[model samples]
Target: MQRVKAVICYDGTHFSGWQVQPGKRTVQQEMERALTRIHKGEHTPVVSSGRTDSSVHALGQVIHFDTTLAVPEDRWPKALNQLLAPDVQVMETSFVDSSFHARFDAVEKTYRYRVHLTKERDIFRRHYVYFYPYPVRVEDMKQAAPYLTGTHDFSSFCSSRTDVTDMVRTVHEITVEEDGDELHFTFRGSGFLYNMVRIMAGTLLEVGKGLRRPEDMPAVVEAKNRESAGNTAPGHALYLVEVRYE
Candidate 1:
């Protein structure tokens, strides 16, 4: 058996997230179905680097699968794209050592959140950006971002629905940039808890809008309580930008 690594990009507008559910349409389900067809009815499982929530898009999601087929690496993307839905595409593929596991081998990940700060909504970007019309003090958000960076218990920003007890994660960076009426928040970290980025974005947004003080961020992180954080932003605005591996 050979392990194949593929870089995937998807719109995530209509699917039920990356993982396969009993009856829901999902990115993994579509990928596995295509692989199954490629192997002539044999089931093949594709493992992703991480699970993204419903409506959360991806520019560089990575996955790996073991296959017995002899398809060439250069043709993998073309072959898979032909079978996948229009919204999901396999951008690149290559053979790797059998020991390379997409999830286990990942060393870092970057996620981007887009926020639209205009009074009128742009229908074209409605599916990709969070609409926050309230005036934001961008500098204040930047100041608060540093407090959330580095290693800490992120339980306050994680979703209560998650069962994972370990809330500690290292955030290498959190950058907020403004371009016209849009604010781009990029987060790079070792890993993230369920809904962690969204909650952090919401908390930072509160600070930006002057509803919360930037100094409160350190206290929020220290509290380790979900109630200490701000609201959880919607998932549609988040994008899994890239995953890194050593």
Candidate 2:
């Protein structure tokens, strides 16, 4: 058997998520189904770098699967693309060392949340961005972002439904950039809990709207309670920008 790694990009608008679920359309399900067809009806298991929530798109999601067939690496993309849905595309594929793992070997992840701030929605960006047609205090949000940097227990910013007990995570950086009515929030971190980026976006939005002060960030982190944080932002505005492996 040979271990194959693939880089995939998908518009998650039509997917239930990345993982396979019974009676649902998903990125992984489609990929595995394509593989099954290639293997003459035998199910092939595929593993992803991480799970992304519904409506959350991906620009550089990585996945791996072991196959016995001797297909050329370059042909993998063409083969899979022919069978995958229009929204899911296999961008690249290659043979990798058997020891490599998509999830366990990942060193860092980057996520981005996009917000379009215009009274008149842009038809082009409506499907990809969250539209908030209100005034935003960008400076306040910038100031609050620093407090969230560094290692901390992020229980307040994580989904209460998360099953993991360890909520501590190291945030390498948080960048807030604006271009006219568009705002991009980039988060680079070692790892993130379920809905962590969305919650962070929501908290920062609250800071921008003057509902929460920048100074409250440290206290919010200290509180470690889900109720102490702001609302969970919509999933459609979030994207898995990249995953880094050492």
Candidate 3:
């Protein structure tokens, strides 16, 4: 069998999520379905770097699977793209070492949350960017973001329903960048808990609005309570930018 690795980009607007669920459309299910048809009735399983919530998009999500077919690596993507739904596209494909794993081997991940600041939301970009027409101090959000970097127990930022007992993760960096009428919150980390990035966006947004002190961000991290953090931002504006493996 050949171990194949591929990078896929998907518009998650209509997906239930990445994983397969009964009676639901999902990225994983579609990927596996395409592979099943290629294998002529045999079941095939695909594993991903991580999961993205419904309405969340991806640009460089990684996945792997073992296949018996000896199809040329260059042709794999072309074969799959013909079968994948329009919203999910296989961008790159290649063979990898048999021991490589998409999830456990990933050493870093980058996520971005986009916010469009305008008096009126753009109907064309409505599903891609979060629209906020209110006044916000970008400097305030920048000042408060530093406290969220480095290794810490991120219990306050993740969802309370997360099954992860170890909430500790290293956030390598957090940058808030402005481009014209848009604000981008880019987060690079070792990994993230469920809803962690969205919560961080929400908390920093609160800081921008003068609802939270910039210097008090450390205390919020120390609190380690979900209630102590800000609200969870919506998923539609979040994108899985990249996943890295070493």
Best by lDDT: 1
lDDT, candidate 1, at 222:
96
Report how far off residue 111 is in candidate 2 (Å). 0.4
**RMSD in angstroms between candidate 1 and the native structure over all alpha carbons:** 0.7
Stretches of candidate 1 exceeding 4 Å from the true structure? none
Question: Number of clashes in every candidate structure?
Answer: 0, 0, 0
Total clashing pairs in model 1: 0
List of clashing residue pairs for candidate 1: none
| Model 2: per-residue Cα lDDT over 19-81, one tens digit each | 888999998898898999988898999999999988999999999999989899889999888
Better candidate number, 1 or 2, judged by lDDT: 1
Candidate 3 local lDDT, 1-246, one digit each (tens):
999999999998999889899999999999999999999989999999988998899999999999999899989999999988899999999899999999999999999999888889899988899888889999999999989999999999989776789999999999999999999999999999999999999998888888999999999999999899998888999999999988
lDDT of model 3 at residue 38?
93
- TM-score of every prediction relative to native: 0.98, 0.97, 0.98
Task: Compute the lDDT of residue 131 as modeled in candidate 2.
Answer: 94
What is the TM-score (0 to 1) of candidate 1? 0.98
